[model samples]
Target: MQYVPFTPYRRVLTLPRVRPSMALMFFARLPMTMTGVTLTLYVVSNLGHGYGAAGIVGAASTLGMALGAPLLGRSIDRYGLRPVVGVCGVTSTAFWIAVPHLSYAVLVVCALPAGFLSVPAGSLARQILAALVPAEQRRAAYSLDTILVEASFMIGPAAGIAAITSLSATVTLSGIGAIFGVTALLIFLLNPPIRNEDELAPIGSVRPPLRSWLSGRLLATLLVAAGTLFCLVGTEVATLAALRANGDVGWTGLVIVVMCAASMAGGIVHGAVKRSLPQGVLMLLLAVLVLPVGLADQPWWLLMLVLIPTNLLCAPTLAATTETVSTMAPPAVRGEAMGLQDASTRLGLALGSPVVGFAIDHSSPAWGFFAAGAGGLVLAAFGLLWTRRRRPAAVAPALAAAVRARR
Candidate 1:
């Protein structure tokens, strides 16, 4: 088949509501990407706490989000998007607005609820994309979404740091809170579809049982998704450690931008192409490529160059994972399924940081890279084994029926 590079993206963009929805979601996610770093800065700079204390609040919030995602998603499935968004929006806005006014202890206590009610923007974006874009073109849609994610990360943290460093934390945080409220209101007003028209269930239709849709294949996909995050986060921690060890900390931003650029390039190609690597294979390559990055840690630029190959797979791996989950999940429970994907990725991020940090602390940054790759390999291996084991069990009923017919 004759291939046109821009055709896939054009097709996806041409779909009804895809363009405006994606644009709104892009802006909506900016505040989300900023919140973590901004909160850490606020805790350390304003509240007179150390990084460790700041991390406590951050960890609490992460835990809350990890626990809350599936529940919020289920709520969306049952009650629909607006009600959940309304409650979460008001709660999140109230929490962020109240942050600068609270004592450190109170802040910590509030962090969990704040995170629990934080709008499920990322998952919502994927759900909307799945609803708006047809299944056949979802790879492109998700790839584009992943590219936007990369762009958001590249912009959000730096902007947050700049804002917090220049303005008072009180002002910056209040601004963030205001942004949250405004974006939430915008999302409510837009009210994007979460399920395709054809896939919409009739009134009183029961959602399929969890066991029926959450198949072994889907579980394996989630495992791979988690592994993808594990490797990426670990790589990031290792990179920072290596840079700090080599006294190249000042160049950190540049190195990160380069890494993001590589990932964006890869995402572009992945979306524009007719076919690309499977999620498992892309994730495996992502993990494997990072294993040797620490060897080039001396010159900061060299380390950045070595990091590119692994990062190049980043957006593609993420996009493929989203596409896979969207495909495997029925529309009725897709919100919950995407929520699980979010939880799994968060768990991976939660585990990656400390585990890789410990490795870098005890041994060397090189070992951190090794640990990250090894951890990813372990998850990927387990997923592979799980699918292989289920294959025979899945085939057994068919085999029995064939044997009876022959008899």
Candidate 2:
């Protein structure tokens, strides 16, 4: 077979449905970034609650998302995209609309259900890309997707904070709900493909058993993905703690922007090149690069400078993980597999904040960086060991077959 070289972003952009689907998904994802900080602000300022109380609500919501993502993905696999989107979109909209009206106690109680039903925009976007972009070109497609994700994060929270501060939480939240409703409607109407035409199974075909597709290699990829997020989020937590400790809190936004920019730059290069580092290697580099960041924490600028190295690996690592998962999963179960990816990353984010926070609280802000990097290395080590252990068994059968043929 003649090899067709990938033309980077140009090839990815030219694919049918890739552009519009990405555009819609980008707007759809903004609410995801906005919701967390917006809810935290609402709980603290409007409900007259402490940050601790707000944290409980945020934790509850995150817990719900973590639990819900895979299940929703399974639903998409079984039922198709529109049905799942319709239900989640309406449920999520109703919850957000009711958020302003609920008491703190009631809001806390409702947060989980609301989060459980929240639109799985990020995973959906990946599913759409996998369906729309051919396998050979997916690296660039996913890289562009990762870049868009970073861009959304850069804008979303700031927009949320600005709106909440300038107006009432009631108004801001209601507006967010409105945006969710509209985006949901658009997604429903658009009904982007979730599987390539050839990969689609017949109606009522037996779904592949979980054991068949959820292989050790796939799990290892998920583990690496979780580790990537754990390191990144932990780094963010450490950066914040470092800034607060150094009386440079005001520079936090600039530092974060710089970090995002560096990640985007890395992603661009990773996609444009014919070859980039594998997910495991990129993740390892990411964790190792941040280990010494604590030493530069004195001035926020210096800390930001130190952070650029690790941050550069960020989007590339994420894009690689998505590409690996997409390749490993059968199209029949791709939604569920993607959902698992979402769950793993969410789990990482959930764990990173507190674990790193504890380190900063007990020792010094510097220790937070240590905690983050160390935790990442530990997770990556486990994935590496797991992959190695599975390899001999995986190869033995093929080797045996080859030996028998020789005989």
Candidate 3:
């Protein structure tokens, strides 16, 4: 195992952000979540686009993310977070203002660049957390970030959907756009230097292509992990909608809210762990317990109960994965590593929806949960074996031992 470098960081995670970098992140996400799912709804329902056309636009958003993430991260690595985030916010705002009127074709074109440049608020937040926390404690830092993002997802879409349905999609788009504008301003006004910049070499005459950072086994593994998580997101939400359990559209969001709340609560509790546990054990437990998520019937009252223990471990699992990525990637390529992680999750969501939706259409809506849980189990097992194989023989035993302990 490679030793993770430690930096002297203290508790901003424990206290309020004096500069409130997280606030900037919260606002920046308003458009990202809204655009990906809710805004797609607006295009199909309000705008003159077929549902199939919405799929194309969604693909464009993924394409934009895949194309843009590494580039944006590299820019942050080279120039600074301030400039890239500012540019992203500006372009995203402009895209929103245009979203209401643009032809499906135009929206597709715009989504590519817009999604790409939109300040990777999530990655930026993680970067800040990485710099702010001591390396040993980075797991908790990432858990906190994940909790915040889960909260954001819970709230952002509800607000966006309500704004679009009652007021107008245009109004919502403008509102979200304005939020991004504010985000740009906040990031610039704060102008906090990222501590991780030292990890990257000074951008000299030549910049490497996005592929250099992403086209590697390490990046591929991290992306796979991230993609799996978002697949859970997609599958869970779609199944809830298909079942129409509990109540109405609001209920669908509420169901997800329950799950997100569980995740956030889990993160809080997980952060308090002083003793290290075997990761594979926790992951397998989570995977097995989560198998029941697929069986949630109308009014999934028991789902929360089932996830109480399972949920606590989820964020930490992912956070640990993030830490691993950070440790594995050279500093010069850190941004690309993060970008791939982000892009993978985004594309995974887009991809997962169709696959799970198909299951709901044919087999049963409940299958989504089982698939996610089962899929997670398979992947976690893969991760453990993969990690062991990648390690030298001596290190492999420790990893295998950890896996055994987890199982």
Candidate 4:
């Protein structure tokens, strides 16, 4: 395709039903970013627990999300968006509201369920894009969605922490619950096209076994998405550890903001640009860029400069993964496919912190950086190899048809 500028994004935004749906999605998903930070702060400051206690609570939620995402996605695919989202919204709201009132032991015990019931807004948003936007325009749409996700990371945690510290944790947590209820209600009212049963019927019409939808191609792309997050989060942890070791811990927030900003900038360009690099290529580049972050250890500014390259690829890799999954899965099972994608990302994020932390503890912060890059490369290689093996087989029938026509 000829290289177009930001015109594609402009066209995408102007399309009917696109703008409002995007807005709803942004509000509805804010809780994803807010929850962990709010929980961390509440557990530590309000409950008078240490970081270790806060971490366990956070892991409970992450584990819940990892387990729940696919099942909920299946529900959305089989039923529809409104009922599934509404139920989740209510359950999640109740849990958040009850968190502060409960004792520490009770809070820990209930944490998993709270996360389990948390709305799968991320997957739902992607499903809407798949259903509403045409295939040709979806790349830009996904890019925009990915950018919003990054924005949530920037806004959600900051807002959540700020509110909890400034106002009462009880009020802030309750307010978060209220936001969930209202966002879910608005989504129900807007009744995005994804809510229509007839539209999703074809996905199940053939009644193909779920195994068929869980194609190798789909799984490989999911791995790429997971690896992308694994590398990104691992690097983040390593960066923090290194900063702490250097007695520059206070600068951590500024450094992260710069890196996220770089990713956002790259995402904007990736969306606006007509042609872009393949997902595999972007993942490989990220691995390479992150590998040397450890060498910049002497000075804080040096670490910031080194991180720019890897961070720049962050959004592009994510946007590309979403676009690939959207293209690979048929409409009938797209929700499940997206759900699997969601699960993979959560798994990566959950694993990244521990893996890098372990490396930092056993060796040094530099080793943590090295491990993130090396681990990311290993995952990227697996994905690339899977694609290489699958491509020729996928096209063989078409090639055979061409040969027969020649004869």
Top lDDT model: 2
Displacement of the residue 401 alpha carbon in candidate 3, Å: 24
Report the poorest 10 consecutive residues by lDDT, candidate 3.
3-12
Question: Model 4 segments beyond 4 Å from truth?
Answer: 1-4, 195-204, 392-407
Tens-place lDDT per residue, model 1, 1-407, is 88889899999999999999999899889988889899998888888899889989988898888888988999998899999999988988898889999999999998888888899999999999999999999999999999999999999999999999999888999888899999999999999999888999999999899999998988988888888888889999999899999899999999999999999999999998888999889988999998888788879989988998999999999999999999889999999999999999988888888889899999999899989998998887777778888888879888999999999
328-404: candidate 3 lDDT, tens digit per residue:
65566567667777776676566666766665666665676666666666666666666566556446677889999
lDDT of 1 at 216: 91
Candidate 4 residue lDDT tens string, 1-407: 66668888888898888889998899898977898889888888889999889999888888888888888887877777888888988988888888889888898888887787788888888888877788898888988998888888888988998899899999999999889988988887787875334445543267447776676777788888888888998998999899999999988888888988899889888888868999999999999888888988647888998998899999999989989988877677777788899999998888788888899999999999998988888888888789788878879877999999999
Which is the better candidate, 1 or 4, if ranked by TM-score?
1
TM-score of 2: 0.97
RMSD of 1: 1.9
Cα TM-score of candidate 1: 0.97
Clashing pairs in 1: none
Instruction: Return the TM-score for each candidate structure.
Output: 0.97, 0.97, 0.82, 0.93
Q: Compared with the true structure, what per-residue lDDT tens digits does model 2 show for residues 1-407?
A: 65344467888899898999999999999998999899999999889999889989998999899999999999999999999999998988888888999999999899988888899999999999999999998999999999999999999999999999999888889889988999999999999999989999987799999999998999999998889999999999999999999999999999999999999999998888888999999999999998999988989889999999999999999999999999999999999999999999998888899999999999998989989999998888888789999998889888999999999
What's model 1's lDDT at 284? 89
What ranges in model 3 sit over 4 Å off?
1-10, 14-19, 196-217, 220-224, 245-250, 276-284, 307-310, 393-407
